[model samples]
Target: MPFVIAVLLAADAVSLMAAGDRAFAARDFRAALFAYQDLTREDPGSASVWVRLGETYARMGHDLEAGESFSRALRLNGKNASAKEGLAASRERLAILSPPPKPVVDEAGARERYTAAVRMINERNYRDALNALDEALRKRPGYAVALVARGSARMGLLDYDAAAADYSAARGSDPSLASPLFGLAEAYRALGQPAKAAQLYRAYAESPATDVQPALKEYALRNAQSLGSQ
Candidate 1:
């Protein structure tokens, strides 16, 4: 009777482990997690079980739990690659979840505010231009046009570092935005990154255009001159 009971328990553990493997293979992370959780409970000494559980958690975006499970797996089987990979991924996910210190705001309303700021900058209203750009960014997060305008405004104000940051953000939001790329090139040049500026300028020159050939030619010539100076 005792032997039969032991065999039944073993069968149950094997069934759970097989189910977990199937779920993992299917990329059904939630189902895998449940199955692995059951297996881990049934066979606490199984390091592979813990590794699978950790992998499932990581796939499901439960970084903290994944980390803990991976750690436990490593404790039992130090050479486990899956556990090590899960631990690394979990740490990376946790790092991403960590909030940065600075506040970033850029949105749709930023377009109007940035346009106004550009007008103010043209009129030599430096301080007002800065304030308007700031307000625009505060209202619209990740507004590429506003970022480019703010960078341009900052450049006029001689705030080179801030201008570079704004230009970088603008370029990041839309890599194909020609104006922002131009602004980045100019910003980099101003900041003494002449090589970087020339590279960006070259990119701008090589980019395809939908506009008139005359404008494209002029833009290409300007970038060529800038690159030559570098």
Candidate 2:
């Protein structure tokens, strides 16, 4: 009975996907959006459906919504090229609306993109935030905050290798910033470099995180003592 139900659901998904494709090809994006929305609810694990939904939102000039969908798709399957492209495009589209980079300390374009990335992160749309931070780093290669945020997003995506690299760069660039210390420690632990992680956790525990996130300082203090003991 379960096997028959699965087959029936799959067939329904196929039929709905065909309808969405037709609507998309005809440029009836509203219809396509509706179809894809239904499909996403019916087949929530389908990365392709989420990607199609994102594409429809993009065509409608709803970059934020598009980004959310693309991020969800990537969460389900990070290797989905269409979802990756859609996420990047969504970030780029929003970045274009802001003023151009100023060539000074606060490059306006980079700041805009970085802010967009933060907004996405706050929404738990880590993939979109990662894409935006990548764009921000391209604009300002030395943006430590963007690097740190990218590390956090990569950590969310379970890309520990990239996360470690980004956190290390950010930590090297600005040793005073406390947030990256915790994040770097986290990445190192994930990568099986417990010694490196423990050191950074100690640093994080000693930093002035009480001014911003006292909870982080306490968490770091625990990790600093626990990683070595374990």
Candidate 3:
């Protein structure tokens, strides 16, 4: 009975290998991949089975998976020439798939977009201001002034959530900047977060930035006091 069971298992393995080979030869790589995957699960110790799975993955343009499968085969049998070749081929293909990093935008280009956004904001054209700010931010991801401006534009458009996000980001990028704190306070107030709004308003009023005019500080303090009363 034991001998019979062993023979049956061996025959099943052979059948799966043959099925995979036939599918591979017919250019049905998906079917080949499934068959080989099953064979690998059944006989994980077999380097040849892993090699077949790796080959199917390569044919299907799954270079990363192919490389992993080939690496597994190499671990099982360090003498696996097919696994070595497949790993190298996968690496070559992967390198081709990955493009070079984008070149950094020049400072002047980012400033140009930012200047346009400021002009549009002054004209009360919040929609066009947002478009310009998007380009500016893409060119310079951590532009604190631009983020503050974008927050104001979002406010004008009644996009309170986005305004809050931009204000928060601006504050994070330049903690000492009173403009972002004021913007963030207003955004929080609009978002119904009164406690946060009050805290930020007080902070903006107390900020030591010389550009924060006396009238603006007085207004911020008034808002903070009003929210505190609530």
Best by TM-score: 3
Residue 100 lDDT in model 2?
A: 87
Itemize residue pairs with steric clashes in candidate 2.
none
**Can you tell me which runs of candidate 1 are displaced by over 4 Å?**
1-109, 209-226
lDDT of each: 0.82, 0.90, 0.92
CA RMSD (A), model 3: 11.1
Better of 1 and 2 by TM-score: 2
Q: Candidates ranked by TM-score, best first?
A: 3, 2, 1
Query: For model 1, what is the C-alpha lDDT against the true structure?
Result: 0.82
What TM-score do all the candidates reach, one by one? 0.49, 0.51, 0.58
Ranking by lDDT: 3, 2, 1
At residue 181, candidate 2 shows an lDDT of 82
lDDT of 2 by residue, 1-230 (tens): 59999999989999999999999999999999989999998899989999999999999999999999999999999999999999999999999987887664548888999999989988889999998998898888889899989998999899999998898898798877888888889999998988889998898888774333787778888888888787
Off by over 4 Å in 2: 1-106, 208-212
Choose the strongest candidate by lDDT.
3
> How many collisions between residues are there in candidate 3?
0
Relative to the true structure, candidate 1 reaches a TM of 0.49
